[model samples]
Target: MPTPHRPSAPPAGRVDAIVLGTSAGGVEALTHLLPTLPHDFRPALLIVVHLPRHLPSLLVEVFSVRCRLPVHEAADKQPIQPGTVYFAPPNHHLLVDRDARGPSLALSADAPVHFSRPAIDVLFESAAAGYGKRLGGVILTGANADGALGLQAVKRRGGVTLVQEPSTARAPTMPQAALAAGEVDFVLPLEQMPAVLRAWGDGGAI
Candidate 1:
């Protein structure tokens, strides 16, 4: 794996899960980012992308073709598994919650935040509550400010926070908002993010 030239000291805890949020240019961005993660990458990945609630998402199919890791549309109560990538199903908010059996996925039809049912904020905030210091939150290319507060929540809970550098993003609004909100741990280009994530997946000592 490539060495991560992080902006700050990497989080000391093992990252149990990674939550990523993106909109506008998400497909293009993820197309580059997901393929770089090895098949054996250990942290579970959860993602949210803004889409029309009435339409079916082809994200799982499209990403599975490029990503080495297994990809699935997140299901309610599904157990979180290492090396798997879960995408929020259209119209539902995807959340992570710890139960007697460990961390599991939850789907909510609750009101949308920032006009999105599968809001990035909901997922990141829920994951922050569930994983605390063990979670890693990524805010990538998007046209909205949905993820800013959520990234802050992750940082407040002591989780690592990564924001795509606005200069390199197809849509800088989301990352810019996150940076403006403060407490972001890393501001990196798309290429570097996978390596940083891989290092964290490999137990964080790169």
Candidate 2:
């Protein structure tokens, strides 16, 4: 077997999971960010986006084709795994179970937060509670302030938080909100986010 690249083993302050929140212009941002990663990129990623409850999700289809990582819609109680990507299906709240030995998914019909069913705050808060400092959060391009508070929650839990820089985003609202709400560890453009996250996945990308 080929030896693993030393840098790929897991970075300092290594994070095992990432939770992303995006909206409005997210598809374009995600398109760029997902396609560039290596298949073995270490962090298990979960994401949420606002969508109509009745509509089917194209996110899984889109990212699966665009990303090297395996991608799918989250199923209730499914355990979180490394080397994969999961997207919250339209209409439900997607949450992470904090139990490390048995990290799991939770689906809920809880009323929408920030007018979104799969609200960013719900995902981030759950992830914070579950993963604590092992989690990393990114608030990408969007039309609303949904992710700002959630990103704060992640920071409060000692997890790293990142926000897409407003000027670089296709939609500036969400990123702006996140930045305005609290300080984040990283403020990156779309192109840099994947690289930054990949660096975090392996070892310190700082």
Candidate 3:
């Protein structure tokens, strides 16, 4: 495989939150990534993984056991907590909101973008607007082009963007689409992601 890409310069600031999006092969991909985050990992993680709209998601239960950090299905209006991982509930669109109390999660029933309700684009775009340069956006394996524009929005707002190396992905279309949209900070294999995320969360050079 080709060498992974890294940014020319280290990121400028701490990443307060990370927005992750995926679909096909997402469960296995997340299993590899999230469990590697140390218990004290500083940034909050908001994740969107495509799921059957009618069935309840078991992501929280599944990851809570594997990850050292707290994991929950995102609740409407729940405050974003550092070190925790929140997955968008089935059938709902997850978004980021900021208010006097600070940043929180928001769920929407509005029409899906790219035919997925918990669309990667919805979460990524909202996080870009809410957290701006303090946010980090990651696009992993998926079958379609859901996350491309959202990752573009992250780059436009001066946030850090990362995509799984397309050749290493179980389903490459999503990552490929994200790469086609524009430049990103990194294109890494899943094995390398946790370290970079740790560096970003710790406000250190990667």
Candidate 4:
């Protein structure tokens, strides 16, 4: 068997998709981040926020009112569309997979990891595999360590990784864990993330 050559790190402005993981303060964090993205922001945004599995998720409805992009709750086997915001639906883990047609979203009802059905790790790992160097992984405010290893996996694939600055996060544990993993490419305040994403969306430096 031959070793596969990994591509060089992608330019900050070359991001094709984004996968974000947050928990405890997710709604507030997303409220601040989504509305600030430029209307024409190009990369598709995928998100996972910890929620009760049994109840219906209203995340798409809530975010659609404020987000610059159209928001949709991910449905199983749906193709990922650019410039859209997709949220993991309650009770299922959202995953990204590449097929002959292109990248598509998948939903799984497997047992929970880190006590979360829609675990951040599940989404991050799958997106990292699907998008590789073109993906950008973000870890935001949360109380658990769900996203740490998955973010590291993104970095290992030469993808850019960002973590919220611990001091500024509503819950610092998640960001702190990712930072401790020693793979994050940037640590920034939440207020600055949307601008960075906007710049990346514009093909400008992040």
The candidate maximizing TM-score is: 3
Writing each residue's lDDT as its tens digit, candidate 2 over 1-206 gives 97666853444647889999999988888888888879989888999978879999998887887788999899998988897899998889999875656788888999999889999999999998888888899999999999899899999998888898899988899999999998899998787777788777887535
When 2 and 4 are scored with lDDT, the better candidate is 4
Colliding pairs, model 1: none
Model 1 alpha-carbon miss at residue 112, Å: 1.2
Residue 65 error, candidate 3, Å: 0.4
Candidate 4 per-residue lDDT, tens place, 10-76, comes to 3445778999999999899999998988778899999999998899999988999998799999999
| C-alpha TM-score for every candidate | 0.93, 0.91, 0.94, 0.93
Q: Which stretches of candidate 1 lie over 4 Å from their true place?
A: 1-13
Query: Comparing 2 and 3 by lDDT, which wins?
Result: 3
How far residue 183's Cα lies from its native spot in candidate 1, in Å, is 1.6
Model 3 C-alpha lDDT per residue in residues 1-206, reported as the tens digit of each score = 96564566555447899999999999999999999999999999999999999998999889999999999999999999999999999999999999999999999999988999989999999999999989899999999999899999988998898999999999999999999999999999999999899988987778
Sequence-dependent TM-score of model 3: 0.94
Lowest lDDT sum, 10 consecutive residues, model 1, at 5-14
Q: Higher lDDT: candidate 1 or 2?
A: 1
Q: Considering TM-score, which of the candidate structures 1 and 2 is the better prediction for this target?
A: 1
